[model samples]
Target: MNKILIVSQQGLARSTLKTALYGEHIVIEAGSAAEAMARAQEYRPHLIVLDMDMGGENSAEICMTFKEHDATSYIPLILLSEQGQKDDIINGLHAGADDYITKPIDPIELLARIDTHLRTKEYFADLEKSDLLMLFELIDIISVTRNPKKILDIIVEKVSCYTEVSRCSIINIDIDGNLAVVASNDLKKNQKITLDLKNYPEIENALITKRPVVLEDLGSNPLMAAVKDKIKHIVNESIVVVPIIKKQNVIGTFFLRTVSTLKGDRAERMNKLCQIVANISGNALENAVLFETLQSNKNMLENLAIRDSLTGLYNHQYFYARFEEEFSRAERYASPLSCMFIDIDDFKKVNDTYGHIAGDLAIRKISLMLNQLLRKSDIAARYGGDEFVLILPSVDQAQARSLAERVMTMVREVSVPQLYGQRITVSIGLATYVNKNYTSYEELLHYADAAMYRAKSAGKDSIFVTG
Candidate 1:
């Protein structure tokens, strides 16, 4: 509904205006120019009605003040004066009144003029919003990138900048009814935020029924009486929640909150726009999810070709390819690079005593430990049977030796239940590149392997470092 502020010192005229506008609009009555100006700033009414005889000397100043201020300048003002005051009408227009009506109050003429101003304001607002929502570039990017979260972040940020709302958020609702805030204008400040719809009955009901929810006057709505106190932090006066659905499934919701109330045609237009946005958002999210699934499948197929079947670690062939890449990068950067060749101590004896199943279990356990103890830049691979290799970039001889010792200790302490009472241990050989002594990557691997043989011969379960 459009808001109209009536500034009239005469009680009879104020009451008459209220009676005419009451059901069609929300009317704010002010007895003086000071009160009217205060209400204009606070409520930001759509149209302001000023009485020329209302506030003595400050009356004309108030009209000029509203016109000059950014917040109130767009609001159309109509001056009310005595019938024969030609000079007063001219003065009111000069002070920035959009239109003037001479009184003894013609109700029909006043109502008609108010209707014209309100329609004009609504039309302009629609045009501005339409321009804001026409984001062809964003839609095209979402189609090309398959990164929905990035697009959603852009959507939330742009929507907040363009809209009249205080806050805008896109929430993802899971199958079990858990709400996760996927994208929002405040994501950087509040990470991984979630809300329980069970606490917000209005929203919960909307989701259940698959419809849009609007709290036009949140503070005064009796339906929200039970949760009103709790909602004060959530919304100052109004909010709208539109569901985003995919393939007949309600996946998420778009939320908008406001400090001032929205009603009637304004609320209706917002609802329509939100529905269109929700549809676009829902389709984008679905495409993102589908793309992620397809990518995961593709990655799994590639991994099967280059990963150890038992441990799911990179196989020897893939490890050799990665080693060349890392070696070249380290040489160019003149960075410290280290390699470790690890062998399971007496693994043949364990397999003969316990069976092949126990051997596989032990291998899997050690592979997991390698992953857990290593940094993201460090690469670990299952190099053929009962052996593993590690590429530790930016690690020197001392650091490599220390890491090898830690791994040896950890492997010794591991007790595989499948191997019964037998404890598992590993012997490691470490090699570092001080000044690229090895001409080829094969020479580096051979040096690490020779050191591993020395560790095994030196009564196993120990680390041997070599250059």
Candidate 2:
């Protein structure tokens, strides 16, 4: 409720104005200007209905004093005067009185003026609250430490709390115009693949034009083609697609969907809110995309520094690093860790028979086959061309031998598409490091390398264990 201060000396006049305002506002009455000043500081009224003629001295002087004081300077002052003289009205306006009415005042006019000013203040307050909440929610989502997809999920959930946009989804468009849903508050379990826009060109055109597509009938609409099969009965409802733009180019779109069509004032109101959501979300999405892009690039570069580019497997240097890490972990936890050094059988002969390109392809295919067989915890690195190494943490001797056999089987079974050969095989040497058995990880690898030579001499495609 708006606080209103009434400065009038007569008890009768105060009671009359009290009845005029009634229950619509809280009225604070003061008999003298000094009392009014005190109440002005305390009440901080939205509008002050001041009687200039109440004090014995010139009323204009009191209005001028109210204007000079910072506490009452910006408060909307409605001057109440005994006479509406041109000179007195001019003086009142200069003294910061927004409007003046001659006393005895008309009740209807006073109520109308008070209602207008109070409504204006309320409008500003609502806008301020909306802005604060949006900033708070956006900051909360950005500060989260989970996966990138989780951030998109939080954004979708918070949009409903913001305004009347009941639901929102965040989608990302790849270079080929495939629409992949990054996050959605609704449909959390749905994992349908990319939406082909070629089948639904109207939605694409609407988004690119930067105009919202207000669909009254979805069954016949062009955009419905993209969403119809996925959501049953959704094509029969209304949809509003607001395109999210970044740097003048459209990145993705937000769906403001409803079960029924809105017309007249409601449609216009929703349209305005949609524009506001677009402006704010567009800027936010751009920043998120830029941050995510930089992060992805950093990860790509870090992996490249430690990975073999040709085979997309870890390099020999990474194997050394992992060996040290696993050795330290095994010693600390008192768990068993093992390694296997593998050498492809007759790789040189296979390369000479075909070409270096076929050799490269063979190595790549073998690497992939081994990867498909290994668990995610296992690390496979290309120790050198035609040779690889595997590190298994928390694995005993028996489990390591079993894992090595599975990898050999996978290598032998895989069919290389380009350079076909069924004679490809591998020789693997296994070594295990129990508690305190090896002082350094280098010695562990040395034992495994020795066993690898034993396997080569004994027979190809056979695993040999360290003594």
Candidate 3:
């Protein structure tokens, strides 16, 4: 059962409605808008029917006043009049009438309109509840995924469709007062209104303040007026900008607007849905920040694990693992390949005179020199203190020796800035497997190691190879 106030001055219209709605509802009759307003405040009716032709002088003005009134604003209003033109109906609708019922109103049609509007109001209420539930689910999803951009994408996609909005954009402000266009939906991307936040100071202020900024019309809002004028072709009608807030700090902004004025429950839903997106987006941003911090630490640890601390080349373990891969590849393809072992000659004498710091610098210098001289196919690794190794594929012993000699000469010529006058010599051992001659990659490395020691034993600053 519902409470309804009917404002029909015509005796005929009043009698018919009262009898029709007698059993189902508490029906109150008011002869004019003044009486209707009085009765509405006193009774708090859920519905009001206002006659356009005889609604206390100016029916349109009365309708507006009724809507503006705090007591009757929430109650749905029905406008009845003889003027049933499309413009008249539109004006009535625009004047805060929930529905427009013309003169000589059909009892069945009139009742149906009432039923329909009431049913719609109930549906909107249900939609609100469902939206709240969906919003909670959205928050959970955002919290778990920890991806702000992805969450924004979902927000624009799901929420805009639910609310049937034209487009959506989320603008994030950085510390320097500049803003970045962080995320937008598919519909938003093609939108001509490119909200390049960099140019808008008002949006920045709104974002910084963590407030909801709604521009019912760009032409009216002073802040948007100037920017709107510049890009008037793109920005027209209503625009809603909700600040993304978290922990009492303004992180960013979520923008929702349309080329046309968004009206009724959809308008309320749009504004609220934008706020909801802002709330969850803020959380997602926090998680994303924390996630990036953790990933940075993890990446640092991974780099340390695989890289030599001194020379920053691949460590011995990493080298061996990659060597097995490259060797297997070469063996399968029967491609020519080469491996070279290098040891700094009289490294102790240099370390003793120049100190450990200088020894570290020397290792780094040699590593850089070798890296610069080697081909992209070659992999260089620090085997141990003052020792390095290289795995080169598709090369014969002749080519390997030539590359080794070139590297050795380059190392000798490079001026170690700190050890200006001191000469740093190096001994090298080179081996190659042009065909699948070796049993495995390990045998090739073993042969290279023996050759390196031979070079060291024969004489310092010399090259050795196993036939």
**Whole-model Cα lDDT of every candidate shown, in order:** 0.74, 0.69, 0.70
Model 1, residue 147: C-alpha shift (Å):
26
Candidate 3's residue-wise lDDT over 46-91, tens digit each? 7888877673377777888889999888888988777325466677
- Measured over all alpha carbons after superposition, the RMSD of each candidate to the real structure, in angstroms, is 29.7, 27.9, 30.7
| TM-score to true structure, per model | 0.38, 0.38, 0.37
Top lDDT model: 1
Mark the regions of model 3 whose C-alpha exceeds 4 Å error after superposition.
1-299
Off by over 4 Å in 2: 1-297
Clashing pairs in 3: 336-394, 336-395
Better of 1 and 3 by lDDT: 1
lDDT over C-alpha atoms for residue 350 of model 1:
85
Given candidate 1, what's the lDDT at residue 311?
Answer: 74
- Model 3: how far residue 309 lies from native, Å: 1.3
Expressed as tens digits, the lDDT of each residue in 120-191 for candidate 1 is 534545544443455454466566657667767766775566656566777765433456777777668346
